[model samples]
Target: MELPEEHSLGAHRRVSEARHTISEILTRSQNEHFAKGNDLDFSYVSSEGGRFRVNVYRKDTGIGATFRSIPSEVPTLEKLALPPIVTKLCDFHQGMVLVTGSTGTGKSTTLAAMIDHLNQTRRLNIISLEDPIEFVHASKNSQVIQRELGTHIPSFAEGVRAAMREDPDVILVGELRDADTISMAMTAAETGHLVLGTLHTTSAVKTIDRVIDALPVEQREQTKSFLAQSLLAVVTQVLVRTPEGHGRRAICELLMMTKAIAKLIQTEQTHQIPSQLQMGRDLGMQLLDQALLAAITARTVDPDDAYTYALEKRAFQKYVTDTTMLSKLDSLAPAAPVPPTNSTD
Candidate 1:
């Protein structure tokens, strides 16, 4: 059900097809509550042998829906071009790790790979609560229980609360959408589970602020303290078109929650996170601009692609004027830092 983003279909045909698809998905969802709103979100397997997370809503023109394809076979981290350091995340017994980005930037894909890595290597119980389960995993060394919202569960907050009683070693909340859900996910981390979640923000600093802002003013400080203690890493990613124009390359900005970062979160000084990211290179943290520059120098991504998604345009422009500076930037030493350690779960 992967329709072209831009299509020449007539207005009437588009509306008709959209309604039909919505009806089909509703039939599969078997939830009587779908008629309560102007929009509905669900997942359905098409007759054409594709699994998709479907969203149907009322647009100005008429009814419209989007179908995001979910691959039947889960891909590996190396296949997705993720950094090797990502493998280290699986070793953490308990903490919160966030995979963040704008929509369609491969955030879910990255998380799926991480979960799959755990499935292959660890003998732990992994439970994922997704709005509509995508990239279904066949448990390997680990036991995975994936719950779909509206189908298998009521809400993410409820799902996480249920997971606590399920004796889960790892809990993956698809996205921290609201105050209640965020609170529950944080509590899950605080108690004794490794919680992996996603947010819509484009950078690690904003991700921290967004989580705090979602809560009430009175609860923000308490939430920050919880986050400072339980939070582990935040990976912000964006997909840029490859230089060959055949596929997309992911430019990742990784932020490992170190003692300094934890202190910043505890004090609600999130603005300093960008500075920490800049100097925390030895620990594998990098800014989006740095990742973009490295990709450009390596010819994995085009200059235009880098400029289009860069947070600072001037940063990339410097490489354009001075050709020899690329070597200096590439040869920069990584700062020495201790491996990440978290307090009691």
Candidate 2:
């Protein structure tokens, strides 16, 4: 059979093919007694070699599907073009490491990479509770158990509570979406398990606020204390198309918890967390603008894109232009030869 032309495969064609494929997959899985649910989903690469994380839902007519590409292979920290500091978070044995960003910013991929690294290098048991389990990790040196939300358990909170009994060293909660899940995750972290999770927030401070605010007003104070004590780091990332226009790269804002940050969180003065991050480079903390500025100076990302996401736009503009800051940035950039001037007209 001839495949539809790329351009001719419009939304309708794509949707129709998706619906048909999903229905077929569901029918086959059901016939095999796969115990698929009403909201059955799976992640796989297509025949064309495009990786996809898909959701199949039962509609009135039939099954409908929505798919997101799961890059063929997991990306290394360098392959993703993330900053070096990102790896530092993985060094911690116990605490919470959060990857926060807007939807479609590759948060799941980043978390998977970290978990994969641990699975390969650390001889520990890792338990992941995902709604649909996006990435499938094979057991390397570590034992990996991936439990799906609806199929394996009723919810994230239940999965987390049950993971405690499994004696997992590392727990990956797909998302900290609600109060119950967040509270359980905190408990896991405080009890000496390394908890990794994602949040839909733009900045480091906002990520902190989102967690604390997820709890009730009366519980806010105690929640802050719990977070301040167990929080290890928050990595907020954004995908920007490269200036050369090849593809995309991530610019991350990493907030490493420090004494100052902990104090601020404990005192309920999270508004000051950004400034603390701005000044706490000694602790490996950085603001989003700092990462953007570095990307801009290296010419890895466009200046406008960097400026747009910068938390301190004016400071970022000045840092990109200020001779002192430029000198520092230039030192960080890759070494390149000076261009030769033309002698002949």
Candidate 3:
């Protein structure tokens, strides 16, 4: 598939290499391939020293692979155009901070940047658990120990469980993929370690909901209580093309754990949290629509594209040239969401 120029992930062209050559690349990238249908994700160091996270697998037709380049240097918050609120989220000594988004939405990159910031400025020891680790960090002000899934550790839950015993001041759970991992990470947070993690959720409310929902039905309230206490913030983002169509930038929403917000979470009143965010602007809270509106104002994103990610669709209607979207938002009894298109980014 030919990726659009505005694609934030990678690869504009389809693979044209010979099957044997592609197979060779896959084999050399990872010593041994997984079963035909299973994706083997591993990082590859090119002969020239560039890095890429590759997924090699087989499909109905034949072998298939996808490569996402990894920069040798991890970007700083300033470089990513992230608000200072994100850096502040990293400053907390203890609590859980989640950087969330769907696949290819730059959650991993954002996490790496936050970790890079901690690595450069803090004196604490940081431990990271990743699958096919992307960016590599060298110890600077802080000591960083990165463990790969199936390499140094068995699973994220086990890795996080083990990190607690390792005297770590900070833990990075690459993916909060299961219930045990989420619960353990929260436990670590409650015990005075700053735990950072990622989820496939697209909003702060949904992110909180997902955590509680992932637990057993009987454990939801307890998990909610723990999350209300331990969660520091949730920064959710999406990368979209600029109106000029030259490049892409991340639009993010941040929710700092204020007392009111905490109370709402503790009581499972999550749907009303967005109102708290809007009122807590002076306290550094942000909403996805607010971010999207800002991006539209700054000419950083196309109006139609921004509309797809906007929670308050009416807010974006003025900017969008297409009146049909506005009609969709207004014409329904209760407006339906304007869903986003599929993007590797």
| lDDT of candidate 3 over 41-87, digit per residue (tens) | 88878889989998766665445667788989998989999888888
Model 3 per-residue lDDT at 70: 95
Model 1 accuracy (lDDT, Cα):
0.84
Model 3 superposed RMSD (Cα): 9.1
Per-model TM against the reference: 0.85, 0.78, 0.86
Model 3 clashing residue pairs (backbone)? none
- List candidate 2 stretches off by more than 4 Å: 1-18, 27-51, 55-66, 315-345
* lDDT (Cα atoms) of all candidates against the true structure: 0.84, 0.80, 0.85
Which pairs of residues collide in model 1?
A: 282-335
Please give the range of 10 consecutive residues that has the lowest summed lDDT in model 2: 1-10
**Local accuracy of candidate 1 as per-residue lDDT tens digits, 1-345:** 333333455755765675566676686444345555546666778899899887776544555567778889898988988877677887899989999999889888899999999999999999999977888899999999999987788999999999899999999999999999999999999988999999999999989999989999999889889878888889999999887889898889999988999898987778999999999889989999888988999888877767768877657865454455455445664667989888896
> What's the best-to-worst order under lDDT?
3, 1, 2
lDDT over C-alpha atoms for residue 180 of model 3:
92
The candidate with the higher lDDT, 2 or 3, is 3
Instruction: Indicate whether candidate 1 or candidate 2 has the larger TM-score.
Output: 1
Ranking by TM-score: 3, 1, 2
